[model samples]
Target: MDAASSLGIDKIGFASAEPFTELKDILLRHREKGFESGFEEPDIEKRVNPELSFESPKSIISIAVAYPSKLPNPPRSEPGAYRGIISRSSWGSDYHDVLRDRLAKLEAFIAERVPDARLMSMVDTGVLVDRAVAERAGIGWSGKNCAVITPEWGSWVYLGDMITNIPFTPDTSIMDQCGDCTICIDACPTGALVGPGQLNSSRCISFITQTKGYIDDEYKRKIGNRIYGCDTCQIVCPKNKGMNWTHQPELQPDPEKVKPLLIPLLTMTNKEFKEQYGRIAASWRGKKPIQRNAIIALGNFRDQSAVPILSELLLADPRPEIRATCAWALGRIGGEEASSALNNAQAKEQEPAVRQDIEKAITAVSQSASR
Candidate 1:
């Protein structure tokens, strides 16, 4: 504990490197139900068995680093000048890098004591299910929202794990404290939380926002101004109500970057996006998804001022997805500018999908005008 505390890891727990039998059953059922986001590791067996990752693993070390829940003095998302929100998890330096460094340090510390120690570390992108490791290792219990709810950090902690050959004493597991609380389930904007702790990632706003291609109209409507990820479920959780972690300087958020102006995001070049957002976790999908989400947010806001910009993108944007989303946005911000742009693009738009969207947008604009 002293070594972990010095290494900047807030919490650590040890669990026997046993196959996640129950979790495998749940995962198979989740896959059968099409609940996966398609971003998960394809090999379920490898993810459940730590032995597959490293030789003769005796225990898995789960680590958690707490982060702030609140965005202090956040920028206003007013009327025409609306802003898009990035999830709290995406704030500060890329956590993947931070967690990896911490894990490396922990591995070295363990090696000092156990000369023959063999270790393999993983962040969220690792083969192992981070939450399962954390749960078994006693870092925290899996909440109804699918987050590891720590006693000290609530659900506002990042998770990572290390599979090792050391036989460390396992910690006591924390039981679920959610009881009958269904607030997180009810707060999910896109009905992504299909059941307690069971997520339908296909309908999840967070997954939808990160999608590289065109977003479904249903999800686009619910995404609102969330440019990167959704936090509705976490925000409403009783465990996270007043919890705020600020000790780690590297994890502290930049207010402007996390809650950036929607309009400016649409115009950012690849280079500009990289320079501005390269350090953050949300930028992992690159600028396209964020730009696309910003476009959707503009439409959702119905900011008439954005009509000119969105109209330009609708008429001349190189990317079909961008053009299609602009068409969708223009529909909501409909006026002479938006309607004229959509109508003019109808004949010129070559992509069948985009053209169909333009037609739908035109109809939406016409209906709005009629009302």
Candidate 2:
């Protein structure tokens, strides 16, 4: 085998199918919403399991691509005002695109060797519990943040899996190295990491970013300037400090997304939003969530400069959710101008929830205007 194929080890033998018998029992619990099995969908059980055989499927090959980057510190004096905190993983192109391309290439290599091979690929898909499989395959141990942590890559890597009829040798699973470190749990701003190796998705900033509508005014204030994803837990982990890794160049973000200026993202048109974020994982939530997040970040920044943009969103956006969030942001921004804009928006808003938000904004801006 050539060097690339040799490194990927597509020719290795499969772990015995019998060993995976227990996997089904575990998957049962994983499909539940509150479970950490990482299986997000209920239907996945029918599609993948020990019983489902690849016509020639003999082994599963899993690959991990490290995504660690040298993160710069957010400005400390007014920590929340700093807009530099892009989730290190998402600052570039979507990892799914990068990992999928690499997996396809690897699958081709395996197919070249085994002509009749069948391949099923998953990278962060609902079908397979990626971290569990990675642990079983000996790639890394699950860290307290619930992310797989490789000794070399730290916890900053994207995982990919390919199941083929060709049996390949399995890698040995590694022992947990967390060693009682509770750094990730402590670092979570929202207490999302409630315990070791457990995450409450509802409390996670990353999850919040994916959600649309008026988040609790308090929650929006806590969200800081992160418009996409949050990486505070990962950032504080000792393992990830100063680590960099080999990344697929294609997945790198557009320069604008690297550390987006909050002002521009709020003003992006539907066409512009699509043009900029359409291909990214963040885009799955649509522009509304992102725009809402930008508004919150602007509120957190307390930069009156964002007042005009937030005001425009308050009036121009058709989505009641956006209107509500903008109202809240204007409240947080607190100025005579902000109050006037919110008051005007409140007059036109038909939605009760939005009208309430406008009232709250009026209250907050009224308070800020007094100061």
Candidate 3:
């Protein structure tokens, strides 16, 4: 325990590495309901059984490292110069790398003691369900929002786990403290939280923002100014109300990079995007999703100033998704310039999908003008 603290791991607990039989049933049901975000591991066995990660798994170690919730001196988003926000989960250096380094240190420490302690560590990308491991390890209780809420750090902690071939007494599981608390479910913008601890990830803004395609209009408008991820559920959770972790330097947010201006992101070259956002977790899907979300945000803002830039993208952008999203933004802005651009796109846009988008945008503008 002292060694983990020395290595800067916020919380650590152990649990029997028995196959998560209950979680397997739940996951299968979730798949049948089509609620998965497609980012999950397809093999349920790998996700539930630690033995799949390593032979002769005995116990699992779950760790949590809390991050900051509040963005100090956040950049203002006014009329013309609207900005987009990345969620706190994606704020600083990628949690995956940070947690992996901590896990590696812990693995080294364990090896020194046991000499034969076989270990495998995993962060978010690992096949194991991190929250499930955390629950079993007594790290925290799974909240109604599907976030593991710790009594000390609230739901602001990032989780990781290590599978080991050593017999360790398991920690007591934390009792669910979210009795009658539907705050997070009610606060979900897309109603992704269908029930307590049940998330329809397909409708989740966090998942939607990461998708590399044109989003449906309903979610696009709801996405508002969020570029990378959504924090509405966590932000509204009463348990997480006042929590703000800042001790970890690696998890601290760069205000400018996290809450960035929307205009500049639309035309960022791959090189520029890599230089600016390569280290952040949100950049995993590359710039296309973020840029596409930015266009939707500009449209949602209805900022007239963005019409020119959006118009150019509508006509000249190489990516069909970008051009199609630009069309939506232009129609949403709805003015002489925006309407003219959509009209021009209607003629020259060759892609069937893009053409449909332009026509819809033009019709939407016409409808708005009539109203």
Count clashing residue pairs per candidate. 0, 13, 0
Residues 1-371, candidate 3: write the lDDT tens digits.
78788898999999999999999999999999999998888999999988887899999999999999999899999988899999999999999999999999999989999998999898888999999999999999999999999998999999999999899999999999999989899989999999999999989999999999879888889999999889998999999888899999999999999999999999899999999999999999999999999999999999899999999998899999999999999989998899999988888989999999899999999999999
What C-alpha lDDT does candidate 1 achieve relative to the native structure?
A: 0.92
Give stretches of model 3 more than 4 Å off: none
lDDT, residue 156, model 3: 96
Task: Answer with 1 or 2, whichever has the higher lDDT.
Answer: 1
The local distance difference test score of each candidate is 0.92, 0.71, 0.93
Clash pairs (backbone) in predicted model 3: none
Worst 10 residues of 3 by lDDT: 1-10
Model 2 quality (TM-score):
0.86
